[model samples]
Target: MVTSIASVCLSGGLTDKIHACAAAGFDGIEIMDSDLTVAHESPEEIRALCERLGLRIDMLQPFRDAEGVDEDLFADTLRRAREKFRTAQRLGTDLILVCSNAATATVDDDAVTARQLGELADLAAEHGIRLAYEALAWGRFVNDYRHAWRLVQLADRPNLGTCLDSFHILSRGHDPAAIEEIDGEKIFFLQLADAPDLNMDVLSWSRHHRLFPGEGSFDLVTFLTHVLRAGYTGPLSLEVFNDTFRQTDTGRTAAHARRSLTWLADRVATTDSHDDRRIPEAQCPHAVDFVEISGADLSTADHMLEQLGFTFRGSHHRKPVRLWTLGTARLVLDEQDKHETPHLSGIGLSVDDSDRASARAEALGAPPAFRRTHTGDHELRAVASPDGTQVYWNDQPAETWTEEFTGGDDGDSSGAVVDHINLSYPWQDFDEAVLFSTSVLGLDAQASSEVPGPRGLVRSQVMRSPDGVVRVPLNLAPPTAPTPPRHVAISCQDVIGVAERARARGLQFLAVPANYYDDLAARFALDTAFVDRLRRLDLLYDRDDDGEFIHFYTPTLGDVFLELVERRGHYDGYGAPNAPVRLAAQRPAS
Candidate 1:
């Protein structure tokens, strides 16, 4: 199946992020609720930006602590949900993420939580929206995908679905194979994120240490294989919440995301074709529809997607990340700089036998300077790509490892299979990149494209193994947009609630125009009360059968910004049409 990423994984403010995702080659984006909260933009304005950026708000996420609360708290949450649903209807979005009750939630009853969430889901369905129930890495209860799925089953609401997050699921040492037993329809959204193997708690790790896929110990290929085998055919959104990525350059971060998704897609191709548990290609879902990459240098990173043979999909020119395309999969590159690497950093893979797909990379020549670490279910090995980029490969799986050590199945899983990689090259090295990828790396050429921008046009290429099992994209930008920036996007159920909380928490925000909403009311026949409420909250919107997609914009620090969104109906796209409005909003007041 294809891979995707959540925008929260990246760093940067909303206005500049859409450009970042488009540049990174991601298929779709998961708009974080927090990002939108930071932007005091109206719903119509936000919708206009997504339309301009050519991105789909695949899932509006982060409905926090809705379940298992006291009646007073639950009622408050219900009110918040209603507001979010209203915002979702304006933004043309559909899926709302309801995460497991956090430590702040006092109730310890899973049944109560399930009932509460089911009630919310039923209410959401009335608005043509679905709630994707998720388990946090440090949730008070229901931290595992299986348990969360069971909760959804128990809820028995048609509007309730499961969100399979790689970090929460694999980080807890849970078996991804449980995916094989789940019905694909029940699974609505798949949020993918990876982290280095470290001796830390899941909560801290998720918030502080999450890296891009292939940069950590999670066996995404195996995990996704099980997911696809279960008949899941949805976008796999990346949701890395790292501190380092928050401060890096925006373009570079976007490029890293493009490369990571390319790598994950290749790994999926190899893993799904394995003989031990091979499934028909038709049974499997399409490759990643979108991804969110985090780290600095996002702008240049987006330009780098061309090197990987990814096309400029589209982006929120006013947001932090850019979206790019490699075949059908989408990659979103972000640069949060959350105390993470500042260079072209991500996970990488290489194998000796092309037949058996290796989840971790095997050194073809001399091993580079690196070390290994252990997480809950996997082992991570770090190495440099041909260009001396920092890339990690997970060497172990959960089922085969013991409590103390992690190891890889070199015999069965190791072979000369290349996962995927995205790398940046100097403008002068553009031709050299082609030579290096095709000759030195012995990879087959895939496709090539160029993108235009204020800076100028950028060029790129993709190289894959002869069997098309492995892929890599190398990118080069002209002198105009030389530096990359950091960016990120996150999905959530309620943008208005997040915005209210963020404001209450004393977070600064970028403002939008009231005139935009005045015009919006004339175009769409929305409930006047809802329109007035959105205008008062400064939320933005767009519409489709998927629902209304809502968004917000905020400030940037160290190349990082945050995005928040809500999906109400069946909409799956970045609000591209909102670009001009967002850009104008970002402009200094006259």
Candidate 2:
């Protein structure tokens, strides 16, 4: 689960919200609709910025009150849904959040609400979107995962799904066992959060006193175990709506989040290792696609990962450098010079053993960057990556560990696994880059290919995990063409899925030329209807002998533009053959 967190759920709209979440150790972020609008940042701009920050927008949120509304209100809601859908499209996302109807809900009949939700589901499907209906604790119609799940079942639309919220689920006195009966696929989003158990209502408690996982009393371990047992494979977001968290130091808060999530993860691993009376690993078919790394500098990044004793995985073959998969999670290092003022190139890592994993990495020569000790508390070490990135590992006290490290935090975003990363290098030093990656970082070199360009050939290499779960492309600038650095591709099971979700979140995409699709139809022999659909979506296409892949290109921002991709099979290579075609399309008319 790429640790995702709700936007407003964290702090505020400032980069502080991002910084806190990152610092709190989240892998992806869920931008509330108002966050983008409030910041006066365009969806396209946010998409670009997140891409730059190395974060994924798990879901565009607060598509509240979609069901059980009057006709006029429903129309207005649907209109907003369409706008959010387009935002999702531009953001390169696939899930949109639809909280249960609140204020404007004119109707209270669950049956009628379910029917209306079903109609909305069809509408979402038309845009290739999934509506994850969250049952808020205060919601009138549905306020629990079971109730929401029942509603989803009633809707019966493929694109209609439920969101499992840790706060709401556990706060209502629901046990993890509630997850046992649900269909995993129908649970599109799982939100995990922890709060200091109090006498107040769970919703109010969540908004004021929620802590990171392991820091609270909720049985998140049981909850997450149940979620995993139910085979609910999706991103686990840390959606804490806490007032104190808003004022907490960004870096400290992020570190706490990392530690909390890591503790939960360790517990999950142990639970999975054991055969519990309630669930068995063999019976628990669901696996975490990826864990999240939210906050910390490159050194702290190193700290967050090394403390967990995670091994370095491979990185991408194109664009500015980013690496993935150390300690069972993905670490995204923010490489932008803008934040370089704080010199804050950040890190997020998912690890098997949050503590030992990070410690071992430090032993393997990670650079120590920060330290803090209170009373008899042992000094905590933050480390820097070989590239001078900062990160820290979780060292939550043993008791807190039991409380927070429960494989369940209630934030909301999905698509937890890392899809891919793009890296770039100088043509001259490309060989050294490959060597450093394959040997020092412990990744296997997959293949090298020549990208034919107008001037000459651009050579590159693909590196991946031995199991093939990670794929990164290393691209060296051709000596002849002076193009700048950029990230060129993203991996996903469903491009249309990402597109629809991105549309909902207000993401922006670069326009692709129609001629590209015409060429695709002529060359690939794809069904005309499919080609037309791709063209309309502005999605590009390519193929390897194993299968096909889709991609998109944008003008350079910093060193690279972003690529959103859907791979159909073992087509492991970058869609190299399509390189010339895409470049031609993206290049200004000369």
Candidate 3:
């Protein structure tokens, strides 16, 4: 019922980590033995600090290589286990983590291993300590969690229970349904971690690639559901060993860890044994109501919108904002002091309830975004993303807010709508952005991609709503790299017509090299006439079994660009294969 995190998940000294965990609102922490072993403060001082901070030492980890060894090694192991037991007693934590022997275990007999563990448990019981046996993915014999539980059952000691780690279970593709077979009280501790689908050694992946709950590929909700069905009532603790988190700021990592638990609690509330564990519910947005771009002056962007046949709706009466419309698509140009280069600063999502969406976002550790409004103006409820981009939630119709503007004509737009938004985040904040978008906006993360760019590979994680009304491709760039330009892709019923109108209005399109068209002709079955047409307009094309995609990009306006796309039939992709051509073409401006 409590939320906790392991000290190995963060970067700092033992004292600093305890303070950060408490500040981040964690109930307890699993202290790594290595941290305490090299600490300046004594175990008594560390325990006093935890008491002062209102934190509990949930467990002391880890006493490794204690079982499945020779009798001589077992003698030394028993000595080591006794000292760890005393240390746990001083730290005020009654549980110690016992990972399965990864090396130096020649005995393949389960009875011998279980008997040794029982003897160790006997030693722990003398100090009023419990042992939570865990399986390591790289363990020599008992790599699976079920095997660890089997050993615990054979030991039949009240002080010896199994600990379930999500990484070890899910990474090995073990059936979690088997967890329901173990007695709930015998599940002494639970550790959760999410990791990406990798094709390397299990040990390396476990050490370097662990991510927060919603930030990676594992299905933790279902895994926890089975544990709950078994009636386990221990703390929901994070035990992520990530290379990135270890080097990042400790406070930020701790906060990120807490948010993951918040998100996960809300997700598993249906199966949770306790009602108080649930957070606010998340509602998936229906559509992107509008995208707001801010810059010193967006005059060039205004011209680009006009060329694309977007009708000028008008300007805000009390603020420096203008609205443009094309069918269901809306774009807002804010003349703010963000930068000289125009970039996406805000996004408006239409949901069932704006207030509820905001509540869910706030619960997941997103700070409120700043907005200015008068007495009569429609209030925009929004939370800022990790990269400082505002995500506004709206329950009212567009007219309620658009009516505040008065000036230009509302002309026809030929049913063009926003297809997706491409947002760029620095590497340090990329994972946070992923979790924020998924947990707050209720978007499902699709398969990630790496596109070859002029500088390096551009990693794009696509987040899309269930109804396919919204798609956001989060692009990651190195922190030291220049800020990547953002783009708004508008889906038109007829991109050729839109492109022709923009061209006639004197808008310069991004010039695609003729070599690209040559490659397209060699790839697809398009005839010469269609290829020539696409080549003449400098447009890019992609086709899959479902349908075809025809898209073209506009020249960069400051640091923002516009893309017009047409999906023939059921093409659901964002022209990822053609991204390299677009990136190469925009390199000079970049």
Candidate 4:
């Protein structure tokens, strides 16, 4: 399918947006009228630039409040349409998007709206331009696609057809199955956007909170399936209006948008019986093989790992990297990168077929990551995520890499495994990271929650594999705070025992406030002795109807930290209710 994006979805000037879209592999663009009007280049020059970049100006967007107006207002609207038609001609595009009137429509009658649209269509036909009427979710009169489609049929002009925006149709809870009933020829253009469900004004939500497909809660797969069933073969354009996307780097945002379309097309093709062969089948990883941290000095990290009962599994035979293990948990510390601070830099996932996973990631626009390997080392296929984290896919045993360690697993096993990895992203990269986790890694994004932080709210989303073997809890801290440190949480059968052992080994755990224990005792009605034991060990406790959770944290090590957790019964949460207290404890004493 041909992919396109609206110029308004990205940051920067019209020229920058065009170049970014082209570089990101978009086949066409919906040039917002304001973007073109404000460009330094003339329309002809802009058109030439798009042509040179191998991009088509698919549509000139947003001639708003054009129909269902008074007679005099209709005359003025017609003049505005004529001006837009001239602009469209110069921009080398034939279609202009006319959003159903949101304001200034005195005549709400459909007959009048249809007649006025017909006249506008006749005028557009005279200029050899087409008008794609879109029903805004908050339109003054025509707020539904069906309503807009009826008007388009009533107008009955070849130059006029309906533009179905996924946001408008889906956000208003309109039945998209009806779209299949409409003639494909009458459906002029399609704009797609996904959004998180929010209880807010529809107009505000549409304009500010829309996310790219696969990044939000919208059922875009089913949405696109219906559209494809209708036999509509137009460019699948993205028209997201996100506050974050508007301020991010234009090229990066454009690339992220392009990946969304590629992912959506693949999903639609796979879900339906379509013969499109662009994307490969998704490879869901079975388990996390290892987590790699890199730094200039890892002495402190080494000490902490030892205190937490992780046995040193020896350094790589060739590289300056050391492996530590506790049961199934593997932590690789790479001292090869001497310039970087301690950070969780890479993750290795065990999949049935590493090559297939790598291929799928590359197909979805992930950049392949290069790693130097010795003759004895296992060659891992890796890809760099949007935030520069390397994700590696490995075979189930990964013996090639595991056997390279010389120590031969001599140290005591702690009986702990990686429960989850907490990764923090800047506000700008949060959504992109979500998409990457879903589309490239084949993880499912669960419902996101906002945890209270000292500075502000921290949005957390958990992306996990189907069998719950691999879980990545993504956190987005408020921009005002310093970037949140990434952490790895290891789960033990007895966290109390592990905490005591670590304390005896002289590892300083993050102190919990006494008031926190008092509140927990009141909240969960825990036995006083249990609460006292938790407080004494600096542990946090949380429980739900299903089960209970107990966890504690280590002091931050540069930009990384560690957590030991114990989950009882069926407890699936990450002790979210205690996050504020944990944050307070992690904060430096004011």
Top candidate on TM-score is 4
Cα displacement (Å) at residue 399, model 3: 0.5
Write one digit per residue (lDDT tens) for candidate 2, span 38-142: 786677777777777777778888787788887888888778788778878887788888888767777888788888888888878877888898888878767
* Model 3 backbone overlap count: 0
Query: How many clashing pairs in candidate 1?
Result: 192
Candidate 3 structure quality by residue, lDDT tens digits, 310-350:
99999999888999999988999999665557888899999
> Where does the lowest 10-residue lDDT sum fall in candidate 1?
279-288
Model 4 lDDT vs. the true structure? 0.90
* Local distance difference test, each candidate: 0.61, 0.61, 0.90, 0.90
Where does candidate 2 stray beyond 4 Å? 12-16, 19-25, 274-590
Per-model TM-score on C-alpha atoms:
0.50, 0.48, 0.95, 0.98
TM-score of candidate 1 against the unseen true structure: 0.50
Cα lDDT tens digits for candidate 1, 420-447: 3345465533443453343224465555
Go through the candidates in order and give the C-alpha RMSD of each one to the true structure: 26.5, 27.2, 2.0, 1.3
Q: Considering summed lDDT, which 10 consecutive residues are worst modelled in model 2? A: 277-286
- Cand. 4 TM to true fold: 0.98
Error of 1 at 462 (Å): 24
